[model samples]
Target: MKIKVNQESCIGCGACAAIAEDLFELNDDGLSQAKVAEVPEEKKEQATEAMEGCPTGAIVSE
Candidate 1:
């Protein structure tokens, strides 16, 4: 699986980072975006949760 974030739709809610710090983070832009590191399979659950928890529906999975 792969993860991606839609910058325009992000609201800096931090739900993704809250759920999976290893996979996501709030960038200087103040929006929730994927970290530089690759997302692991173990984090899929929290990642998905983050995607769902996002108020703006910014996160996506492929």
Candidate 2:
């Protein structure tokens, strides 16, 4: 799975990073960004959780 953060919609709440540190992080702009273009099999569940946990619905799976 591919994960993406919509910068325009992101609020930088850090919930995604908290839920999936290996998959997401706060960038210099303080918005959450996907650490990898594609989610590793081992990290898919956590990534999905992070996506769902995002308050602004900025995280998305492609």
Candidate 3:
């Protein structure tokens, strides 16, 4: 699975990064960006959790 962050929709919240440090992080602009273009099989669950936890729904499966 691939995950992508919609910068325009992100509110600079750190929920995604806090939930899955290995999969997401806050960039210089304070927007959350996916650390990996493709999700590892083992991390899909964690990534999904992060996506769900995002208040702005900026994270999406690609």
RMSD of each: 1.5, 0.6, 0.6
Better model by lDDT: candidate 1 vs candidate 2: 2
Q: List the residue pairs that clash in candidate 3.
A: none
How high is the lDDT of residue 38 in model 2? 91
Give the whole-model CA lDDT for all candidates, comma-separated.
0.82, 0.91, 0.93
Per-residue error (Å), model 1, residue 11: 0.8
Highest lDDT against the true fold, candidate? 3
Rank the candidate models, highest lDDT first. Answer: 3, 2, 1
TM-score of candidate 3 on Cα atoms, chains taken together: 0.96
lDDT of 2 by residue, 1-62 (tens): 99899999999999999998988889999999998999989988998889888999998898
User: What's each prediction's clash count?
Assistant: 0, 0, 0
RMSD of 3: 0.6
Q: Which residue pairs clash within candidate 2? A: none
Candidate 2 segments exceeding 4 Å error = none
